[model samples]
Target: MPTLILIAGPNGAGKTTFASEILTTDLKGVRFINADEIARGLSPFDPASVAFKAGRILLRETAELIEAGTSFALESTISGRGHASTLRKAKAAGYRIVIHFLWLSSPQESIARVRSRVKKGGHFVPSEDIRRRYPRLLHNLVHHYLPLADLWFFWDAQGSPPVGLANSMTHAISDVDRFIHDR
Candidate 1:
C-alpha cells in the first residue's frame, strides 16, 4: 500500500534525524520531502527567502504523488491546520498514514537545540516562532493528526538522546495524554 509517513513535532525536535533513520531502512523507494531541503535547493544562499515557494512546490509534489498512489515521507511541525487537509486527501487516495512524533518537555528545549544548531551554522528558526508553535503542535497532534494516523509512534525527545515511549498508539495513548496533560 502507498504510505505517507510524517516525521512531526515542534522545530528542533529531532524529526529529521528520525526520518533519516527511516530512510536507511527498507523505505528506500519512498520519496523524501523536507521543506528545508527544498528551500535550500531553491536558493542555497538564502533558503528562508524562498520558503513559501518551496512550500508551494512541496504541495504540488505531494498532490501528484497522492494521485499516483506513491509512497512518501515528509517533515512537519503539526503546529497549524496546514497539514490536515493534505492528510485527508492522502487518506482518500488510499495512502497509509504514519506519524512519528518527537516530543520535548517545553519550548525552551526547542530554543536551546536551535541555538546549538545555529552555532554549528545550521538554518535558524526564530525563538518566537518555536515558542508559538510548541503548544500548538502538541494540541494538533492530539486532536487532529493522531486520529488520522493508521500507526503512530511517540518519542520523548527530552533527553540527550531521545527515547521511544511506545511504538503503537493503542499502547501509548493514555501515557501520551498524561505526558501532554502534565505540562
Candidate 2:
C-alpha cells in the first residue's frame, strides 16, 4: 500500500516548512514532491508558464510513483482545478490520501511572510499577489477541497494546529503504519 499526503495552502502559509518537518520526522523514507521545486529555475514573478510545466511534470512523476507503490507527500499551493484533478487521480490510483491546509491569521500575515521570504532571496510571489489570492484559496479549501480528504487537518501559520488536529495526525500516522505493515 502506498499513501499520498497533499499539503495545500496559499503562498507563505508555511506549507513547505510543515511538509519538510513531516518528511524528516514522522514520514521518513517517503518521497517528497513539490511543484515549486520543479519550477525553481523560473522566476516566481512569472508563475503561469513555470507552474504549467511543473504541474505537468509533477503529474507524470506522481502517476509513475503511485503505480509503483511509493508513498509520497506533495506540497503545493493547490489553488486551481488542475490540482484538484490531480488529487482525484491519486485517489483513483488507490493511494491513501491525507490533506493538510495551512493558513495565516490574516491576509496581512501572509503578505508580511511573503515579503520576508522575498527579502531572504527565496522564490518570490509578490506580496500583493499573495494578498489577492488568499481569500479565494481559503474559500476553495473550505467549500470544495476539504470534503475530498480522507483525513484532513488545518493549521494556523501564526500559531499551532487547530485544536485536536495533532491527535488526528497521530491517528493518521498510526493508520499509515498499519497500511504499510498490512501490505
Candidate 3:
C-alpha cells in the first residue's frame, strides 16, 4: 500500500517550502505532487481560472499513482469542496493518509507573506483575496480535512512544531511505514 501525505495550509503558510524540505531532507524516495506546479505557466497567473482545473488533475493523478503503489507527498491549500472527495478517493485506493496543517502566527502574517511572494514574482494572488480567504481555509482544515487523516500534525510556521508534533516529519513517515506494514 502506498501513502498520501498532504501538506496543506493557507497561502504563504510555507506549504511548498515545508514540503520541499520534507522531500529533500526527511522523506527521501517519496514523489512530490503540487497543484501550483501544475498551474505554473498559465497566462496572468489567475488562480481563480486555473486552480480548480489543476486541483482536479492533481487528484486524478494522485489516485492513479496511489493505485499503482506510488507513495507521494502533495502540497495544496485544499480549501475547495473537492478536498473531501479527493481524500476519499485516495483512501479507497488503499493509501494511508497523513495530513499536516501549517498554521501561521496570524492572518496579518499570512497577508504579509502573500505580499512578499507577489513582490518576489511568484504566483500572484491578490493580498485582499488571500485575506478574505484565510479564515475559511482554517475552517475547512479544522472541520473537514483534519479528521480524515490516519495521522495528523499542526505546525506554526513562525516557530517550531507543536508539542505532540515534535519530530513530526520522521514520525509521519514512521507512522505511514507502520500502517503499510500492518496492513
Candidate 4:
C-alpha cells in the first residue's frame, strides 16, 4: 500500500520546507499536497458558513489520490474546532502509515521566524493585519486544544535546521518502504 503522511505544525513551523526536504531527500516519486495551497484558491468561509460541502470535496479528492496507491504527504494546520472534519476524513483514509507531525514548540520564536520570512519575500501570511492579530491567534492555537502532533519535531529557526528532523524523515521513509515491500 502507498503511504499517506500528514505533516502538521503551527504557523511558521517550517512544515513546508520540511515537506520539501522529505520529498526530495527521503521519499522520491511521492506526491506531496499542502492544505494551505488548496485553501488559498478557495473563497473565504464565513463564521456561520454552512458550506462544509467544499470540505467533503477536498477530502474525497484526497482519499482518491491515496487509494490510487500513490505515496503522498499532506501539510495543514489543525486550528481549533473548525478543522475536525478534515482531520476525521484523513484519519479514515485507508493507509496504514506513520504520521510525522512536525510540531514547532515555540510560538514566540515561530512568530519571529514568520515575520522574518515575510520580510525576506517568502510565502507567508500577510504581515499588515496578521501582525496585529497574531497574539490572539497564537494564544488560541498554542494554548488551546488541537495543538499536539503525533510525532514531534521541535523546530527553532533561530539556529540551523536540526538533524533530528532529517532522521525522523528517514525513519518515515523506511516505514513507507516497508509498507511497499510487505505487499
Candidate 5:
C-alpha cells in the first residue's frame, strides 16, 4: 500500500529539514510536496510574494497525487481542518497514513526559528501567523490526526539533532499529553 506521510508542526518547526533527511534515507523517491520549494521554483522573484499561489498549486498537486494512488509526503502546519479531510480521503483510498510531528516548546521558538530562516533567505512567515498557528497545530494534532493515522512519530526539535519523543510503532510515551499541554 502507498503511504501518505505528513511531516507536521507549527510554522518553522523544522518539518522541511526532517522531511529532507527522512526522504534521503528510508523514504527514498517518495514525492515530496513542499509549498516553499514549489514557491522558490515558481518565480525568479521573492518566493514569499507568490506563496499563496504556490500553496494553491501544492494543494492541486497533492490531490492529483492522491487520486493517482502515488505514495507521497507533504509538510504542513496542521493548524487547520483541511488536512483532516485529506487524510480521510487518503485512508479510504488504501493509503497508510503516517504522521511525523516535530514539536517546539513554544511559539516564541517558532518565531525565533522563522526569523533565523528569513535571515538565511528562506521564505518568511509573519510572526502573528506563527503565534496564531502554534496552539492550533497541537490542538489539531491531538484531536484530528492521531486517531486517523496508521502510525506516528514525535520528535523534540529543540536540539541540533532532534531527539525522538515517541512513535506509535514501538516507542509510545505517556507524557506526550503533558508535554504538549504544558508548553
Candidate 6:
C-alpha cells in the first residue's frame, strides 16, 4: 500500500532531520519530501519569506505521490486548522496516512537549537521569531481540528525518539499494505 507519513512539530523540533533519518535508515523504497525545501524552491516568494503557495503545493504533491504508489515521508511544521484540512484530503483520497507529532517537553532546548541554526544561516526561521509565534503555534497543534493519526510518536529535547518508534512506524505502514493487498 502507498503510505503517507507526516512528521510534524514546531519550528525547532528536528522534524526534518528525523524525516531524513527515516528515509535513509528506517525503510527502503521510500521517497522523501520536505515542506521547507518545496516552500523555498517551488513557491513564489522573496528569498527571505515562506510562500503559502508552496505550502499548498507541498500537500498536493504529497497526495499525488501517494496515489502514484510511492511511499511519502513529509517533514513540516504544520500546526493549523488548514493543515488538518489538507491531511483530511489525503485520507479522503484513499491513502493511509500516519501523523507523527514530534514534540519536545519544553521549548528551551528547541529555542536554543533554532537560534544556533539561524546563526549558521540555516533554513529554519530565527529563534526569536519562533518564540514570538510559539503560543499560537502550540494552540494550533493541540486544538486544531484534524483526525487523530493511526499512530503517533513523540520526540524529546535530546531528539531521541522511542527505541521502537521506527519499528512501530514501519509496522503501521506494513499493516496498511496487507490490507490493500488483501483487497
The prediction achieving the highest lDDT against the true structure is 5
lDDT of each: 0.87, 0.71, 0.72, 0.52, 0.88, 0.61
RMSD of each: 1.5, 7.9, 7.4, 9.8, 1.7, 8.4
Pick out the ten consecutive residues of candidate 6 with the lowest summed lDDT. Answer: 174-183
lDDT of 5 by residue, 49-91 (tens): 8889998998899889899999999999989878788899999
Ranking by lDDT: 5, 1, 3, 2, 6, 4
User: Which scores better on TM-score, 3 or 5?
Assistant: 5
User: TM-scores, in order shown?
Assistant: 0.94, 0.78, 0.78, 0.57, 0.93, 0.70
Off by over 4 Å in 1: 172-174
Higher lDDT: candidate 3 or 5?
5
Compared with the true structure, what per-residue lDDT tens digits does model 3 show for residues 1-183?
A: 678888987888888878878889888989988888877735355655787787777878877786787889888776664666777778888778888778765568778887887799876667777777776776676667766778788666764432233234445444433432343
Which residue pairs collide, candidate 2?
none
Candidate 1 vs candidate 4: which has greater lDDT? 1
RMSD over all Cα atoms, model 3 = 7.4
lDDT of 6 at 180: 27
**How many residue pairs clash in all the candidates, one count each?**
0, 0, 0, 0, 0, 0
After TM-score superposition, the amount by which residue 24's alpha carbon in candidate 2 deviates from its true location, in angstroms, is: 0.6
Per-residue lDDT of model 4, residues 35-149, tens digit only:
5555544644431142255455556667677557566777655444343343344446644344443444445656677887768865565444344444444343333312222
How many angstroms is residue 136 displaced in model 2 relative to the true structure, after the best TM-score fit? 1.7
lDDT of 1 by residue, 139-172 (tens): 8988898788899989897774678887664575
**Which residue pairs show backbone clashes in model 1?**
none
Q: How close is candidate 5 to the true structure, as a TM-score?
A: 0.93
Residue 30 C-alpha lDDT in model 5: 98
